[model samples]
Target: MTGWTAEDMPSLTDRTVVVTGANSGLGLEGSEAFARKGATVVMACRSVERGESAAAEIRGAVPDATLDVRECDLGDLANVEAFADGLHEDYDAVDVLCNNAGVMAIPRSETADGFETQFGVNHLGHFALTGHLLDLLRAADGESRIVTQSSGAHEMGEIDFDDLQHERSYGKWDAYGQSKLANLLFAYELQRRLGNHGWDNVISVTCHPGYADTDLQFKGPREMGSTLRTAFMGIANAVFAQSAEQGALPMLYAATADDVIGGEYVGPGGLFDMRGAPEFQQSNEASRDEATAERLWAVSTDLTGVEYDFESA
Candidate 1:
């Protein structure tokens, strides 16, 4: 997979792809790339209006692109369930599900379900969404892929089981790191469970966009009303980060590449994994701990109340 780009993606005609946070940044770029390859993309955005605008923008460029815009607010489990219900009503099977939506180092806040915002939306939300749709994914004619977006911040993470929600104390970056780490744990655990259930046609993979220049960096600072932090992040993005399209390559590769198997992590292969072409990479050891993954999975299922029906496949 040396120097792999979106142009290297195989045809996705007749495939269905679901991309969360599809309105902007890596999600937008990935959605456009999938659409260009003839995949029927389901833009799962928090805002239906913005999702429609993004769909319109893609249609302007790729006239034949088939797109559907749907509302999926990850912070709210009810909204995620509704979104999945709508998809189940419409499509018999989904070929790819990109767990791309996430919040960065934002101020400590609670989601609608009273969980920490970053962990709630980033990891738990995707976990619940995947469970809700796992059956449909298995119904696909061929192998169906679930590509989840993680981050390099995961290296600094340690799952605080005593306080998974960070209710006792909250450090913004630490919370973000924990959530990102949960992403890897969830992805690896899901892959293992699918294998144990003999569902080889379904696979789960994780990826990270190394220092991608996207609005995600600014949102946290903007939310905290810290102009100085926002400006610093902007300068850093300008100097060190790659474009969103370039950063999205790893996710696209994980989702569509023929050689990609379950449980693999994809990321940029440059200095410190900050930028470059997509390649197979390794996550931190904590992310690979089977015991941790299994415990996290149990906690997630209990928290979200969405259980995977492995036998349904």
Candidate 2:
């Protein structure tokens, strides 16, 4: 099916899910749905206060919800490692790992590890987190899924192997785009690696929220927008962008949907794949290029120092 709704998915009861950046926005929406579906949902956030508050809000909505909040800043490599350890300590099994938390356009900032902010938090952090938690995921009783969030902006991105940290010069949008492109590449390569290793049981997918009017843009500087762009975004959000709940549908589908294929890219089925119901969305040429995906995988492996089980494949 091209377009799918969360309601069209099978039961997710007894499943245990971990969602990074679950404090608010799409991550929180996805966590709420999973918790409401009788799954144990962990809100992995950078701020304990925000994470707990989000959990409380979810509990208020679903009084019988099974939800817990944990803190880990993905921008820090050490923190990512600790988060993986924390997940191992907290859960015996993790059925779904939603690498949902991310940053948008912002003034240049370095992660705790001194890498470019966007790449650090969006791609590298998730890379390490996933690598460290492989055992727990493999222990999950049924199909284990990982859904990585990519963006339409990836079409404009090119990975700079020479200067990934932007040591020479950097533009916010270029950095953001590269990180998002890395996301798609990671997901695609992950699926391929898993298949080669015969761990095809673990599904990995990518998706964009399709211009949902979340805090990603609103929380940034005022210069990043103007009266005109603000008004445009407002109208665009209302007309083309989906609600947070709608935006999370693809994630929820990819997480719990039966018969979902590995490496599939899902997003809104309407207009330019920007809004509507969740469906198999298209990736840009840059993201879809097989060679780039492979090279990026090698780069990621080199950077993260963790290799996927793909030798046999």
* Model number with the top lDDT: 1
Q: Model 2, range 1-313, lDDT digits (tens) per residue? A: 5556656666678888999989898998988888878888888899999899899899999899888888789888777788788787878988999999899877788898788889989999898888887777777897899899888888888999898988798888899999999999888888877777778557788888887867776544555646776676667667766788888888888787776788889877787777787777678877877888898778777877766544421
Model 1, poorest ten-residue lDDT window? 304-313
Per-residue lDDT of model 1, residues 209-301, tens digit only: 999999999999999999999999999999999999999999999999999999999999998999999999999999999999999999999
Off by over 4 Å in 2: 1-4, 222-240, 307-313
For candidate 2, the C-alpha RMSD (Å) to the true structure equals 2.6
Alpha carbon deviation, residue 67, candidate 2 (Å): 0.9
The TM-score that candidate 2 achieves is 0.92
- lDDT for 203 (candidate 1): 98
Q: lDDT for model 1, please.
A: 0.96
TM per candidate: 0.99, 0.92
- Indicate the TM-score of model 1: 0.99
User: For residue 218, what is the lDDT in candidate 2?
Assistant: 51
Question: Clashes in model 2: which pairs?
Answer: none
Per-residue lDDT, model 2, residue 42, is: 83
